[model samples]
Target: MNTIKTDVAIIGAGSAGLSAYRAAKAAGAAAILIEGGAHGTTCARVGCMPSKLLIAAAEAAHHAMHTDAFGVHIEGTVRIDGREVMARVKSERDRFVGFVVAGVDAMPGADKLSGYARFIDDNLLQVGEHTRVHAKSVVIATGSSPVMPAMYRALGNRAVVNDDVFSWDDLPKRVAVIGAGVIGLELGQALARLGVRVSVLGARGRVGPLTDPEVRNYAERVFSEAFRFEPRAQVQAAVRDVDEVRLRYVSGADELVEDTFDYVLVAAGRKPNVAGLALHNTSLELDANGLPVYDASTLQAGAHPVFIAGDANGVLPLLHEAADEGRGAGTNAARYPNVEPVERRAPISIAFTDPGIAMVGARHVDLTAESFVTGEVSFEDQGRSRVMLRNRGLMHVYVDRASRRFVGAEWIGPEAEHIAHLLAWALQMKLTIDEMLRMPFYHPVVEEGLRTALREAEVKLR
Candidate 1:
C-alpha cells in the first residue's frame, strides 16, 4: 500500500468535510480529504435545495387553488403534472449538485482520496485498499444517514426516505409519512398541497422541532387541519403487499385504522455515520451513543488530536451549524496542541412548512418556568396577516425575569422563517426585551406581530 503523510486527514467529503479541508489548508496544514461516496453535499443533493424546490412547487399549486379567498376565481380546475413537477425538481437539484461537484473537482488530486477511511490508530488511517495515511491530526465530518426503523424495513422497496423522494419520476397518489419532525412536516405538507393524499404519523405529540407545549399544540392543530396528521399515532404494524404498503395504527379517536399507500416515507430521523469508522481503534473517549466526546467550542475529541464535527458529532445537524463545526474542527486539528476555542453562534432551526415552525436560541424545554417569563402573540389578529388573508400563527417569546434579556422563542406562524432570523440576532447580541422593543417596528407588517410579542414579554418582565 502507498503511504501518504499529512498534517490533517479529514474523513467524508460532504458539507462539513469540505469546510474542514478548506479550513485546514488555510491554516497552513497539508490535508487529505477522503470520501466513500459521490462528491455532492447532502444539502445540494437531497436536502435543503431539492426539498425547497419541491416545496416551491407545492406552494405554487397551493396558492393557485386557494386564491378564491382573495376574490380571484379561476375559469377551471387547476392541474398539477406530476412528471413535470418532478422533472423541474430533479433538474434544479442536479444544477445545485453540479456547482458543489465543480468546487471539489478544482481541488488538487493529491489532496483528495476516493475511498472510505478507517482509523488504524490515533495518527494513522487506512484508506481502502490502496493507501495508508499518516497525519498529525484528524477530523471526522462523516455526516449522517437517514434512519429507517425496524418495522419500516418490512415494507421493502415500498418504503422510502427523503433522499428517495427527490429521485422519484412522479408523485405517488398516496404517501404515509412517518415522524412529524422537520422532514416529515415539510414533505408531508408539501405533498398534501400538491394534491397527493398524505397521512403524517408521529410518535409523541411533537410537531416539527417545537417543544413549547402551546406552540407545539398550535402547530399540530394547524398541520392536522391541513392534512391527515396523527401525532401520538399507535402504529401496530407495517408490511408490503404487492406494489403498495399497508399500515395499521390506532387513531386518536381509539379506532383502528388500516390504510394502504403507494409508498411509506420513513423520516424518523438521522443517525450519525460513525459506526464504520473504527473509532474504537483510537484513544478518544466516546459517549454512551459511541460518539466521540468532544468540546462543542473546540471540536476536539477529549485530549487527543482527533476532532469530530457536523452530523457525525450529532450536535446541531443544520447545514450552517455543520459548516461552523467543520471549520472549528479542521482548524483545531491543524493547530493540535495549540487549539483555541471557537465562539459558537446562537442555536436556531426552522421548518419550512407553510405557517412555518421555528426555534431560536434556547428552547422552551431548556428554560425553567421560575427563571423566565413568557410573552405571547396570536397572528389571527395581526394587522398585516389579516390583510394577506394568512392570519394563522402563534408566537411565544421567553425573557429572563431578572435580567429582562431576550433568551429564546418558539412559534408557529406566517413568516416564521424570516421572523426567526431577527430573533436569533437579538439572542446573539444578548439584547434585553426592552432594548429589542426599542428597535423600529414597521407599520402593518408580519414583523409587527413579533413586536407585539416583544411588548407582551416586556409587560411580563416587570
Candidate 2:
C-alpha cells in the first residue's frame, strides 16, 4: 500500500469537494480529492446541466410550435428529435466536466484520485488498489444519489432515475414522473413539452411543495395545461411489462389506480452517499435521514476529526450551498489546530423552470420577527415582462416594520434567478426597505419589479 500525507483529504470531486480543494490550496494547506467516477457529480453530468439543456430545447420547440400565437406564422410543423437533443446535452455536459477537471489539475498542492474512497479510520482514507491517504482533517463531500424505492427494484431497466434521465436514446411517448419536487416538475414539464404525455404523482397537495403556496399555485396552473398532475397521491409500486411500466398509486380517497406509461421516472428525492464511508469507525453521528450530523458553523462531525459537507451533511443540499459549505469546511480544517471555525450563513434556494423560482431569507410566516409587513407585485404589471411576452409570475417582499429592513424576498418569474442574488445581498447587508426602494432601478427590466414590490411594502407600513 502506498501512503500519502496531506493537511486535508476531501472525498468526492463534485461541486463541494472541488470548492473545498481550492479553498484549502489557497490557504496554504496540502489537499487531495477522490472521486469514484471519471465524470463529475450529478449536477454537472446528469442532474442540473444536462437536464436544463433538455429543458431549454423543449422550450424552443414549444415556442416554434406556438409562434402563430405571437403573429409569427411558421410553415412547417415543429418536431423534436430526442436523440439529437440528447446528444447536444451530452456534449455540453462533457465540455463542462472537462473544464472542471482542468481547473482541479491546475490548483496547487491538490491531487485527484480516480476511484471510490473509504474511511480506514478517523483520519485515514483508502482509495482503490491499496492507495492509503492520511490527513489531519478529512472532509466527506461525497454528495447524494437518487433514491430508488424498493418497490421499483423489479422494474430496474424500465425505470429511470435523475442520474440517468439525460441518457435516454429516445423519449418515451408517455412518462409517469413519481415526484412533484423540483426535479420531477422540471423533467415532467420538459418531457411534456417534447410531446410526451407526462403524469406527475406526489404526496403533496401541489408541485414544488417546499416552495411557497403562491409559487406552487402558479406552477400548477401553468403546467397543468400539458401535464397530468396528481397531487396527494402515494405510489405503492411500479410493475414492468413488455409494453409499458405500470404504476399503482393510492389516491386521497384510498382507492388504488394503476397508470400505464412507456417509462417511469423516480425523482422522489435523494439519499446521502455515506454507506461505504465506514463512519462507524469514528464518532460521527448519523441523523434520522441517514445523513451525517455536523455542527452548522464548523461542519465538524461531533468530536471526530471527520468533517462533512454537501449533501452528505444534508444542510441545504443545493449545489451553491454545498460549495459554500465545502469552502468553509476546508478553511476550518486548515485552522483545526487553532480550533477556529467559520460561521455558516443562510442559503438562497432557486428552482429553474420556464418561469424561475427564487427565495432568500426567512418567509414572513417562518420568522418570529415582530412588526413585519409583507408585499407582493405581479409580473403582469411589469413593462419588461409585457415586452418579453413572458408576463407570468410574482415577486414578494418581507419587511421588518420595526427596522424597516428588507428581511426576505421571493420571486417566480423571468430573471428570478438573477434578481434573487440582489435580494440575498440586500438581506445580508440588512438593507431597509426605504434604502432599497430609493435606489435607481432601470425601467422596463425585471429588476423594476423589486422596486415596485418594495414600494407596495412601504405603503402597507404606512
Candidate 3:
C-alpha cells in the first residue's frame, strides 16, 4: 500500500473541498485533495450553471411568444429545437466545468488522490485499494446526492434526476417534477416555458423556502400560472408502463390523482454523502438524520480534529453557504494546534425561478408578531413592475420591534434576490430599520419595492 502524508486532507473535490484546499494553503498548511468523482463542482456541472443556461433559453422563448404587450409584432411563432437547446446547455456547462478542472490540474500541492476515501480513524484515511493518507487534520466536504425515491427508480431511464436532466439530448414532451423545492421548481418552470407540459407534485403547497405563511401562499399563487402544481400531494406509488411513467398520488383533500408522464424528474431532496467515508471508524456519532455531530459555526466535529462542511453537513444546500463553511473548516483545520472557531455568515438563499424567490436571515417561522413586527409591499401597484409587465409580487420585512434591528426577510416577487441581498447585508451588519429605510430609494425600479416594504416596517416598529 502507498502512503501519503499532508498537513490537511480534503475529502471530495467539489466546491467545498476545493475551497478548503485553497484556504488551507492560504493558511500556510500543506494540503492534499482527494476525489472519487468529477472535479467540477455540482453548481458548475449540473446545479447552477447548466440549470441557468436552460432557464435563459426558456426565458428567451417565453419573451418572444409574449411580446404583444410591448406593441411588438412578429409574423412567426417562437419555437425551441429541443436537441439544439440541450446541446448548447451542455456545451456551456462543459466550458464552465473545464475552467474548474483545469485549475485543479495545475494546482501544485500534496498529491491529489484519485479514488474513494474511507476513514481509518480520526486523522487517517484509506484511498481506494492501495493508498493510505495520513494528515494532521481532515475536512469532510463530501457533498450530497439527489434523492430519487426507490419507487421512482423502477422507471429506469424514463425518470430523471438533476444529473441526468442536464445531460439529456432532448427533453420529453411532458414532465412531472416530484418535488416543489428549488431544483424542481426551476427546472419544471423552465421546461414549461419551453413548451413542455410540466407538473409539480409535493406534500406541501409552499413554493421556495418561504417560512412565512403569507409569503408562501402568495408565491404559490404566482407560480401556479406557470406549471400544474399538486399542492399537499402525497405520492404513494410509481411504476413504469412501457415508455411512460405512472404516478399515483393523493391530493390535498384526499382525492386520488393518477397521471402518466413522459418523463418523471425526481427533485425530492438530497442526502449527505457520508456512508462511504466510514464515519463509524472514528468516534463521531451521527444524529437521527444520519449526520455526524458538528458545530456549524466552527465546522468542528465534537472535540475531534475532524471537521465537516458543505452539503455533507446537511444544514443548507446553497452554493454560497457551502463555500463559506469550507473556509471556516479550513481555518480551523490549519489552526488545529490552537484551534479557534470562526464566526458564521448570516443565512441567505435564492431560488432562481421566475418571480425569483429569496429568503434571508431569520425566518418568520422562528419569530412571533409580539416580539417582531412585519412590513410588506405589493408589487401589484409598483411602477417598475407595471412597465415590465411583471406587475405581480409580494415582499415582507421582519424586524425586532423593540430593538428595531433588521433581523430577516422573505419575499416572492420580481427581483426578490436583490431585495434579499440588500436586507441580508443590512441585517448582517446589525443595521436598524431606520438605517435601511434611509438608504436611497430610486424611482421606476424594482428596488423601490424594497424601500416601500422597509418604510412600512419602520413605521410599525416605532
Candidate 4:
C-alpha cells in the first residue's frame, strides 16, 4: 500500500479543483490533486469547448449561405460535413485537455492521481487500490453532470446530453431538444443551423428563464427564427424505437401532441456530482439536493477541515465562479490557522447565442431605487453591427437615480460579451451613471452602444 501526506488534498481536476490546487501551491501549501477521470473534466472535454466549436461551425455555414445578401454570389450549393466538424472539435478538445494536464503535472509539490477517490475518514482519502492520502484539509470540486429525465431512459446512447454532443458523427435530419436553458438553446440553434429541423420544448415561459426577461425575449426571437420553440410546454414522455424518437407533450389548451424526430438531446439541467464521495464519514452534511452544505463565507463543509467548491456547493455552476470559489476554499484550507473568509462579489452570467446575452448585478425588479431608470440602444444604430451585417440586438442599462450609481446592465448584441465586463466592474466599484458616461469611448465600435445606453438613461432619470 502506498501512503502519502499533503497539506491539502483536492478532488476532481476540473476548473474548480485545478484552481484550488494552484492556489494552495501558491500559498506555500503541499497539494495533491485526485481525479476520477482525465484532467479538464466536462468543460474542456464535452461541455463548453466542443459545444462552442460546433456552434462556431454552424455560424460559419450560416454566414456562407447568407453571403449573397452582402453582394457575394456563391457558385454552388453550401454544404456542412458533420464528420469533418466533429473531427476538428475532438482534436481541439484533446489538445486543450493535454495542455491542462501538462500544466498540472509541472506544478511544484503537487501530485496528480487518477482513480476514483472516496473518503476513508475525516481527513483521509483512498484513491483506487492501495493508495491512501492523508491531508490536513481537503477540497471537493467534483463539478456536475447533466440530469437525464426518466422518461427518456429508453433513448439511452441515442439521446445525447451536453457531454456527448461532440461525438455526433452526422447531423440528424430532425431533432428534438428537451429544455430551453443555456445548453438547450445553444445546442438547439447549432443543430438547426446545420440543416437539422430542430424543435425545442420547455416548461418555462421563455427559452432562458434564468436570464433577465428582456434577454429571454431577444433570445426567443433570435432562436425561434431558426428552430421550432415550444415555450410553456410540458414533456410527458419520450419513446425511441428503431430509427426515430417520439416525444409527447401538452400544449396550450391541455391538448396532448406527439412529435417524432430522428434524435432527441436532453438538456434539462445539471445536478451536483457528490454521490460517491462518502461524505457521511466526515462531519460534512448534505442538503436536500444531496449537495454539501457549506458556509457561504468560508465555503467550509463543517468542522472536518473539508470544503466544497464549484457545482458541488450549488452556488452558480459557472466556470469563472467555480474558479473563484476554489481559490477562496484553497487559500482558506491551507491557511485555516489565521485566514479570514473573503467576501465574494456577485457574479455576471453571459450566454453565447447569435445575438449573445450578458447580465450583471441585479435586474430591474430586484432593486428598489427612488428613481428607477432604464435605457436601451439598438444594434442597428451601431456602425460596426451594420457593417458586420449583424444588426438585430439591443443594449439596456439600469441606474439608481438617487445615488446615480449604475446598478445593472443587459445586452444582446455583437461584442456584448466583451462589454459586459465593464458593466460588472462599474457595479463592483460602485460607479455612478455620470462617472461612467464621462469616460471617452471610441466611436463606430460596439462599445458606443454602452455610451448611448448611459446617455439615454440620463434622459429617463429626468
Candidate 5:
C-alpha cells in the first residue's frame, strides 16, 4: 500500500470537504482531499440548483394558467411539454455541476486522492486499497445520503429518491411523494403545477420545517387547496406491480383507497454518511446514534485530533451551514492544539414553495409561550399581496418579553424567502421589537406587513 503523510486529511470532496481543504491550506497546513463519489457538490448536482430549476419551470406554468385572477386572459390552456421541461432542467443542471467540477479540477493533483476512506485509528486513515494516510489531525466531511425506508426496497426501479428525479428524460404521468418536509413539498408542489398528477403523503401532520403551529396549520391548508396534499396520511402498503407501483392508504374519511402511480418518490430526510468510515476503530466519543460526539462551536470530537462537520456531523444540513462548519473544522484541525470556537451566524432556513415557507433564528418549539409575545399579521389585507392576488398567508414574530428583542419568526407568505433574510439580520443584531419598528416601513410593500407585525409586538411590549 502507498503511504502518504499530511497535516490534515479531509474525507469527502463535497462542499464541506472542499471548504475544509481550502481553509486548512490557507492556515499553512498540508491537507489531502479524498472522495469516492463524483466531485460535484450535492447542491449544484442534485440538491439546490437542480431543484430550483424544476421549480422555476413549474412557476412559469402555474403563473400562465392562473393569470385570470389578475384579469389577464389567455386564449387557451397553457400547455407544458414534459420532454422540453426535463431537457432544460437537465441541461441547466449539468451547467451548474460543470462549474463545481471545474473548481475541483483546478486543485493540485497531488493534494487529491481517489476512493472512500476508512478510519484505521484516531490519526490514521486507510483510503480504499491503495493509500494509507497518516495525518496529524483529521476532518470528517463526508456529507449525507438520502434515507430509503426498507419497504421501498421492493419497488425496484419504480421507486426513486430526490437524487433520482433530475436524471429523468421526461416527467412521469403520476407520482406519489412520501414525506412532507422541504424536499417533498417543493418537488411535490412543483410537479403538480407542471400538470403531473401528484400526491404528497406524510405520516405526521407536519408541513415543511415550520415549528409554529399556526404557520404549519395555515401552510397545510393552503397547500392542500393548491394540490393533493395529505400531511397526516397513513399509507398502508406500497408494492411494485409490473411497470407501475401500487400504493394503498387510508383517506380523510377513514376509507381504504388504492392508487397506482408511475413512480414513488421518497424524500424521507437524510442520514450522515459515517457508517462505512469504521469509526469503531477510533476512540472518539460517540452519541447514541453511533455518530461522533462533537461541539457545534468548535466541531471538535472529544479531546482527540479528529473533527466532524457539515452533513456528516448532522447538526445543520443547509449548504451555508455546511460551508461554515467545514471552514471551522478545517481551521481547528490545522491548529489542533490551539483550536478556538467559531461564532456562527443566526440560524435561517427557507422552503421554495409558493407562497414560500421560512424560519429565522429560534424555532417556535424552542420558545415558551409565557416567556415570549407572539405578534402576527395576515396577508389577506396587505396592500402588495392583495394587488398581486397572493393575499393568502400568515406571519408570526416571537419576541422575548424580558429582553423585548426579536428572537425568531416563522411565516408562510409571498416573498417569504426575501422577508426571512431581513428578519435574520434583525435577530443577528439582537434588535428589540421597538427598535425594529422604529427602523422604517415603506408603503404599499410586503415589508409593510412586517412593520404591522412588529408594531403589534411593540404594543404588547408596553
Candidate 6:
C-alpha cells in the first residue's frame, strides 16, 4: 500500500472541496483532494446549469406560444423537438463541465486522487483500497446526491432522478414530478412549457417553502399557469410498468389521484454523502439527517481537527453557500487546533421557476410583529413588469422597528434573483431602511419595485 502525508486531506472535488483546496494552497499548506465521481461540480453537470438550459428552451417555446398576446402572429406553428433540445443542452453542459475539470487538473501543489476516501481514524484517511493518507487536519466536502426514495428505487430504470434527467437524449411525453421543491418545480415547468404533460406532486402546502401566506397564494396562482401542482399531496403507492410509471396518491382535497406517466422524476430532497466516509471511525457525531454536526461559522467538527463543508454539512445547499463554506473550512482547517473567529454572511436563496421566488436574510416565520415591522409591494401593476408581460408576483420587506434595520425581504417577482442579491448585501452591511432609501432607484426598472416596498417599510417603522 502507498502511504502519503499532507497538511490537509480534502475529500470530494465539487464546489466546496475545490474552494477548500485552493484556500489550503494559499494558506501555504499541502493539500490532497480525492474525488470518487466525475470532476464537474453539481451546478455545472446536473443541478443548476442543465436546469437553466432546459428552462431557456422552455422560455423560447413559451414566447412563441404566447405571441398572440403580444400582437405578433406566428407565420406557422411553433414546434419543440425534444431530441434537438437535449442535444443543445448536453452540448453546452459538456463545455461548462470541461472548464471546471480543466481547472481542477491544473491545480498547483495539490495531489488529486481519483478514488473513494474514508476515515481510518482521526487525522488518518484512507483512499480507496491502495493508498493511506496521513493528515494533520481533514476537510470533508463531499457533495450531495438526489434522494432516491425506496419507492422509486423499487421502480428501477423507470424512476429518473436529477442525475439521469439531464443525460437523456429525449424526454418522455408525460412526466410526473414528485416534490415541488426547486428541482421538481423547475424541471416540471420546463417540461410543461415544452409541451410535456407535467404534474408537480408537492409534499408541502405550497411550492418551495414559501412562508408568507400572501406570497404563497400569489406563487401558486402564478405558477399554476405553467403546470399542474398538487401542494398537499400524500403518495400512497407507485407502480412501474414496461412502458410507464403509475402513482397512487391522495390529494390535499382528499381525492384519490391515480396517475400514469411515461417517466417519474423524484426530487424529494438530498442527503449528505457521509455514509461512505466512515465518520464512525472518528468521534464525529451525525445529525438526524445523517449530516456531520459542525459549527456554522468555523466549519469545525467539535475538537476533532475535522471540518465539514458544502452539502455534507446539511445546512444551506446552494452552490454559492457551498463555495463560501469550503473556503471557510480550508481557512479553519489550516489553523486547526488554534481556533479563531470567522464571520458568515446572511442567508439567501432562489428558485428558477417562472416569475421565480427569492428570500434574503430572515424569513417571515422568523420574525414577529412586535420585533419587526413589515412592508409589501404588488408587481401586478408595476411599470417595467407591464412591458415585459411577466408581471406576476408580490414582495415583502421585514424591518427592525426599533433600530430601523433592514432585516430581510421575500418575493415572487420578476428579476427575483437580482433583487435578492441586493437585499443580501444590504442585510450584510446592516443597512437601515432610511439609508437604503437614500440610494438611487432606477426608474421604469425592476428595482423601482424595491423602492415601493422600502417606502412602505419606512412608513410602518414609524
lDDT of each structure? 0.92, 0.80, 0.87, 0.81, 0.92, 0.88
Off by over 4 Å in 3: none
Whichever of 3 and 4 has more TM-score, that candidate is 3
What stretches of model 6 exceed 4 Å from their correct place?
108-110
- Write one digit per residue (lDDT tens) for candidate 1, span 1-462: 899999999999998999999999999999999998898999999999999999999999988988888899998999999999999999999999999999999999999998888998999999899999999999999999999988988878899999999999999999999999999999999999999999999988779899999888888889989999998898999978899888999977788999999999999999999998998998888899889998877988889999888999886889999998889888889988999987699889999999988999899998986999888999999999998889999999999999999999999989999999999999999999988988998897899999888888787666
Residues 1-462, model 3: lDDT tens digits: 999889999999988898888899899998999999888999999889999999999989988888888999788877789999999999999999999999999987455889999999998999999999999999999999999777888889988898999889997898889888888889989999988999888777757688889988888887777788876799988889899988899987798988889999999889999989988888887788767898766888888888899999988887888888888888789889567676667788898888889888898998875998888999898999989988888888888988899888888888877877777788789999888777888777999888888888887866
TM-score of 5: 0.98
Tens digits of per-residue lDDT for model 6 on 140-204? 99988889889888888889898898999996899889888878888898999999999899886
lDDT of 4 by residue, 365-392 (tens): 5767556688788888688889889887
TM-score, model 4 to reference: 0.93
Least well predicted 10-residue stretch by lDDT in candidate 5: 249-258
Candidate 5 backbone overlaps, count:
0
Residue 443 in candidate 4, Cα distance off native in Å: 2.1
Report the lDDT tens digits of candidate 2 across residue range 102-147: 7766755338777788877888888887689999998889888888
TM-score for each predicted model, relative to the true structure = 0.99, 0.93, 0.97, 0.93, 0.98, 0.97
Angstrom error at residue 259, model 5 = 1.0
Model 2 Cα displacement at 397 (Å)? 1.4
> How many residue pairs in model 2 have overlapping backbones?
0
For model 5, how does the per-residue alpha-carbon lDDT over 1-462 read when each residue is reduced to its tens digit? 999999999999888999999999999999999999998898988899999999999999988998887788999778899989999999999999899889889999999999999999999999999999999999999999999998897899898999999999998999999999999999999999999999999888889998899899999999999888888789889989898999999866577779999999999899999999999999988889889998777999888999898999887899999998889889999999889997699899999999999999999999986999888999989999999988989999999999999999999999999999999999999998878887877878899999989888888878
Candidate 5 scores a C-alpha RMSD against the true structure in Å of 1.0
Off by over 4 Å in 1: none
Clashing pairs counted in every model: 0, 0, 0, 0, 0, 0
Under the 3 Å rule for N, CA and C atoms, how many clashes does model 4 have?
0
